[model samples]
Target chain A: MAVASARSRGRLEHPRRLWVVGVIIVAAIGFLLAKGLGSSINYFETVNQAVALRSSLGTTTFRMEGVVVRGTVHQTSRGTDFSMRSHGVTVPVVNTSSPPQLFAPGRAVVVVGHFARGTDKFLSNEIMVKHSANYVAAHPNRVKPGANGSS
Target chain B: MIITRRQARRPLTSSSSRRPGSLVRTATGVVGLASVAATVWLGLWVTPPSTNLGQLVRLLYIHPPVAWVAYLAFGVTAAASLLYLWRRTRSVVWDRLAAASGEVGVLFCGLTLVSGSIWGKATWGVWWTWDARLTSTALLFVLYLGYLALRRVPSDPGTRAKRSAVAAILAFADVPISYLSVYWWKTLHQTGTVLNPQRQVHVHGLMAWTLLLGFCAFTLVYAWLVAHRYAVEALAERQQGEGLARALAERRAEGRAA
Candidate 1:
């Protein structure tokens, strides 16, 4: 009779134990979500998503990636303005300060800045010109290149 | 096992009469308090300001060390989780340790984010960015949060432990990746400044020594947090046992009355 009672009690406490465990997990997730949401969106996005979401982005700062259109790069006294092309769509980029020396035609570029409302222009604060596969192959010291690189 | 009514009502220590356990508890408490005190004092006031940022640079002393401690706690969680999974018999203890460490780790990680942001707002024109170090650290914070959440989803203890252990192990991968992502990627976040001995020698005088002392103090505080957390978990388990025993005894008495 004592053995049966002990077994029953153990069984009863089992659910409570699980409940406490669940609470701890929820607390952890809540903590992370709270922090993550406080920070801005800085995660990876393909050119397609950037284009599709272009309308709603407004003037908020963001990052976008595309290939530099061959004939669209024009350097002014202020800085350089160029058009980035991806998936047959083009967005004008105005860089107001120092552009990377590597910025040029047909290069993959990631511009960190903002998109103006009602226009296809992106005002960039920083520009990163993606290195090609040959740059990685020629330089053995470099690790994996961009997202498209393999071997 | 259901405790007898007599044992349930017994004085806490009378049932156990464990001297070594009490000694361990006292030692853990003392060490924990001392560590926290030392870390706070040395990290904040004792450290001198940087020439460039002046007083604002003091934020760096608190922020980086807290970040390091968080990583250390997560490492403990991963190792303990692995042990629990490997030897399933004594896993409850290990799982408790993992959970404790995860909580403290998350707390320190929060501190890191706060202090880092405060420093950034003072130094840089912006609050945050997609820089490799920042992004990876943020991901790490998220991954551990998810790991903790996995422990809670299931009602079965055995199933929860299994799943939590797996999550802990998998999330450990993010730590190294977070540390090294800056080296691999072209990131705005400056590469690690303190770890390399050669670079350490070159840093402007007071800043280097302050950081060194900060690391030491933070490590001790981390040890203290883990120890205290483990003890709290043990005490909670005992209280839980008592609650169950009391419930069983009341049920028995009601049956007799009926």
Candidate 2:
């Protein structure tokens, strides 16, 4: 009977107990990773925060995020200039590079730049448009009629 | 999905045609190969270039689908792992399914990161950034790597299943965070263009059509891949059982006689 029992095969020994321990450890690690995300958020400031800290932010390079004020975008030989606002505070940004196609009025953006405390302007090295995953028309009339082809 | 004790006794051999599900596996292989060829054609030649990125927009056809399937595969793995935890349904089948999905998810996850880098370099003039989305995506890839590694450690089948199931569940926590990283924080990465229904659609016209087809094609390929992988795992398990049986018979014969 002992030999017969030895021949029988089944699950590995101690799986159930080890699994419980693994679950605890994994959950703890996941929680730590989530908490770490707070400290590692991308932008250093919002538009309002940047303005409020303009004096201290003097010439210090940083990335700031804000919504582009509508109709404030302009094309210039230097590149592009726009106004971004948040929480009733607005900052003028001059980006010395062509903006992405998504960079337009009434969109959210992050600008990598330094504060020109004397001129009260943000001199941007790069401009990035931020939006959700939802697709919007890249432009009106881009799609022809009868495009409701969801299958 | 059922494997009887008798079936387990038989080892995997060249005579696989005698195996119960070998026919379906062969058919799946053919379909999967054909779909991949079609995808390559649509992605390279058929899709139009973007107004801005030009030829680089062709990445749109394959990138999104690869990313989507990676997410889908991980999601399935987590679900299967959870099922394996249930007392009534606790079995190695669910564990093997989870592992198969994990392997495929990692393949596509790597593809997604590479394709994304190529597209970014074309448009952003940069190959990489430590932005919120990019970092979270990299984290996701690492988590999957850890999960795969955990599966390979020497252990009894039951213990391995339990550990891997837990790894699958934990690794999946990153998937949602990676997807929502763009919306949750400001980053150099572009917002979600294809999935946001509440906002205006960025991709329009024939691009949208090709993207939809891309998803369909990749999803079908994933299903076929998983099916075949499961069959292979079953064959391997059968072989292991036969090897053990042979060792046991030899030991018994040694003690009993000349």
Candidate 3:
């Protein structure tokens, strides 16, 4: 009688084991989908988007992308001060962190920081350069020092 | 019967029968190595630096080519898996080819991520990011790795091949998603230079030629790797079959003596 009951229990456990495994796999996939999609939906906001949502954002740290306007870069005691423009909207940025080697005027960059309290200036601690796909060979005579307008 | 069987196996194991195929594989390996060297030399010394990116643009020659090879390897795996699944075209050859291509694809995919990370650090100022393009590519690498792991689960050949073929097909669904992620979402990673949807060419002159050469060279290396991997798989399968036969014969002989 014990042997019969044990055999029946073993058979019962087989399908249950499969069910448990299936549920675990489904749950893992669901979690990954949610996490991956949720984070990537808004990887970074453009300068226009950031400005439009500034009030609701309320000084929270986030990444913002824009092109560095030419002739607006200034090196200050605190950090580099510049104007980031996108879609005709320009936002003044004060980045405390040192910018990358490629960071210069007319280059696209993503700055990681937030808006200063009660001020229009964006306070950034990190600057990342974003280069385009265009690749043109440099002419020997045309390549000049500080041609990229780095501060 | 045992002596006769052993004699028959001896010829199959001999090198003479495989001489022609071995010669072709050797030649392919040699050419692939030569082209890779030429690409390195041209990329480093001959090709002029870009006006904007300067010397940093040299990484373009390797990164794009490695990424292209990864895509090609997965594409072949998908095609071979489909052949294995189709009733009219089903064969063990297709299954082996799919497995070989998948392993090679994983290797190239890893190279892609590493090379891309280095390039990103220099240009984007970040070693890694969770943007759509980067995330989807990382997912692809993990998915194929899972597929390879699934193949190792102990099972009979027919059942294993069928399940692995299904898994290969499922994993291949991510390739297109990864390729088009930049277009589908606003990504930190830049879009394709040569294969963009706009049909525009961002590279020019000697740089263009070197990039093309890199592609051809890496592709040849991929072919050589897959060929060697498939040969090894075939040899392993043959040895397994021989072992099974030997064990079965021994059991029958004991039964006869009893």
Residue lDDT tens for model 1, B1-258: 999988877877454535676556566557656655765675577655432334555665567678888889999999888888996555688988998898788788777777766665555434676566676677677677767656545345566676888888888887886666556554444456565323534334555665666676677667767767877877766765676688789999999999
Better of 1 and 2 by lDDT: 2
Ranking by DockQ: 3, 2, 1
Model 3 CA lDDT for position B232: 87
Give the alpha carbon lDDT tens digit for every residue of A64-149 in model 3.
99999989999999889999999988899998977887888988888889999999999999888887777777777884733552
Candidate 2 CAPRI-style tier: incorrect
**Candidate 1 docking quality: incorrect, acceptable, medium or high:** incorrect
Clashing pairs in 1: A22-B152, A25-B148
Which stretches of model 1 miss by more than 4 angstroms?
Answer: A1-151, B1-48, B88-90, B196-202, B256-258
* TM per prediction: 0.59, 0.71, 0.86
The model with the greatest DockQ is: 3
Residue B39 in candidate 3 has what lDDT? 97
Worst 10 residues of 3 chain B by lDDT: B147-156
Clashes of 2: 11
Kindly indicate the candidate among 2 and 3 with the higher TM-score: 3
What are the runs in model 3 whose C-alpha is more than 4 Å off?
Answer: A1-35, A143-151, B1-20, B250-258
* C-alpha positional error of residue B232 in candidate 1 after TM-score superposition, expressed in Å: 1.6
Candidate 2 residue lDDT tens string, A1-151: 1122233334422457446645654664575466447534844588999988888878988888888887899999999999999888898998898887656676667788898758978999887655433332333456532122110
Give the alpha carbon lDDT tens digit for every residue of A1-151 in model 1: 1222233234324667657755765665466445434432344333566678877776877677778877888988778899887777788888886665445577676778887777778888777654321211122233522223211
